[model samples]
Target: MFWWFERSGEHLRLEVLQLAADKYELRVIDADGTARVETFANADDLAKRQTQLQHALSSQGWTGPHGWVM
Candidate 1:
């Protein structure tokens, strides 16, 4: 799983990639996906988010693909 965040006036963007087993990598990208800042973190704190994503694919009356998008 991954996500990006952008602000109104900044040329910088943040890309977060979820690795496996509660690990994740973050990359600060330019508007064109050029890397500016890169780092990794133990994403165990994101347990709830992970569960929510799974539910979105399979539960609460939803259905479709499973797991991360990319």
Candidate 2:
């Protein structure tokens, strides 16, 4: 899955790819091209982590659109 959002006048992109039956890769990239990556054991785990990040961003005043902005 892939997602994108705009916050604080900046664009951010997230890419989630399945690497194996039980492994996945997540890549977060900023508009400036700086990127961070992480691996997860399963989709459920990834979803949990993503939710945590969303909460953190929201707490920091990062607002998302009603649907996907990308």
- Residues 1-70, candidate 1, lDDT per residue (tens digit)? 4443334433433345767666666554555667754334566544544455445534433333223345
Off by over 4 Å in 2: 65-70
Candidate 2 per-residue C-alpha lDDT over 18-68 given as tens digits, one digit per residue, 9 for 90 to 100 = 889999987877669999998999999998887876677668676752234
The Cα error of candidate 2 at residue 46, in Å, is 0.8
> How many Å off is the CA of 1 in candidate 2?
1.6
Model 1: colliding residue pairs: none
